[model samples]
Target: MRILVFGGNSLLARAFTASAPSGAEVRIAGHAEIDAPELLDGVDVVVNFARHPDDMRLPYDPARDVDRRLAKRVSPLTARYVMLSSRKAYAASAQWDATEDSALCGQDVYGANKVASEAAIRRLLPADRLTVLRIGNVIGPERIPGRRSFMGFMLNTLADTGEIVFDMSPFVSRDFVTVEHVAAQLGRIVELGLTGTYNLSSGTGIMCGELALAVIRGHGKGQLRIIDPRHADAFRLDVSRLVRETGLRQTADEIISYCYNLGRALG
Candidate 1:
């Protein structure tokens, strides 16, 4: 299978390129190549990992329409399109795991933008030729420090001061899938010719505290401290569809070990 990829420098793009299956042939497209329709010639699929800046404060900004424009450019091509969406597109739900059919009532600006972006792309490409993957928190060897990347921030703190601090209670949970696993799943989706929206995740929740502790264990000396004792909502994705279709899933222990291993690698 021949593939063309955008956002070639992103973590997902790098992971997919490095971990693609044996039969897959991947090509990273340059900025100029995106405008060239011939770039999609003989390409079986086009996976876009590019992100758009969405600011509700600036509602009329044209810069926020990057995805829509790319959809328009690639719509005429024969290759199927794969879009990487986020789990944040769903409204906060504590009663049940969010499914592909769940209401897209996410309240944040980023979520709202994703909802709009998905709709816009769907309008351009027919359902049979489009695949949207709503992914969860992805973990890898990110070492940057800041709120922009949570794992990176935690690791940086541990490296600098041997401490990992949390503003919310450590028990707060979120679904996390390793970068390598995400890449492998994408290969599965492409190879199987799966279409429509699917939740790509670990199918379980890992507590923030547990992950921090694992990281500390990997770092060999860091400690976890929680500044707030208030409860925070835990969110997980229902991966029944993905598993039934691809025979792929992740256990909680595997998720914990992925974090632990990341800590060891980055420490």
Candidate 2:
């Protein structure tokens, strides 16, 4: 299978290409430097992971443009398209376990843009040919401090300050997932020829504080303290459908250990 990957500079892109089996052909194009749809000339699938930081300035919405181009323009040329979406696209309403059956929503600009992209892409590529991976929080080694990258930053902050600031919300919860697992599962999805939306998550809910505590433990540190609340309305994703689809499951401890191990490996 040939894959034209946009935003190939990302660690995930590098990891996917490295781990991808020999039969698959993966080509990458910079999100900002897309041209002629030349990258997808004879590609089977286009996997988009491009998103704006919101702080950055650009012409038109980046998410919409990529989605529209790939779904409308690229999909017509390719055999199929697989879009990387977010759990945020789900309605704020809490379900026992979030599934593809859950409602679609746009809570904020970030999510709203992603929602728009998903819609446009879906319009171009139906659920049968197009696949949407509504991924949960992706954890990895390059946990840059003070950035939005969830697991790494928090863990680094905890290790440095001993008491990291927090916005405690009983309602807020996240499904922790590892980059390794996500890439592996997604690879399996394509290899297995499955279609439709699937929630790729750790399949467990943990608040910011719990994640912090896990990070501390992963670092072999003692229990930590929480500071305050930044925002309300817990953000959680239903991943039952993903488990059913992939027959894959991830535990919070596994993710915690992965990050900690990454930190150790790096240093």
Best by lDDT: 1
Point out where model 2 deviates above 4 Å.
55-64, 159-163, 169-172, 220-223, 229-236, 262-267
* Cα lDDT tens digits for candidate 2, 85-153: 877777677333667777776545555666777777777776777888887778777556566566556
For residue 25, give model 2's deviation from the true position in Å.
Answer: 1.4
Which residue runs of candidate 1 sit more than 4 Å off their true CA positions?
30-33, 54-63, 94-96, 145-147
Each prediction's whole-model lDDT (CA): 0.80, 0.68
Backbone clashes in model 1, listed as residue pairs: none
Alpha-carbon deviation at 15 in model 2, angstroms: 2.8
lDDT minimum window of 10 residues, candidate 2:
55-64
Highest TM-score: give the candidate number: 1
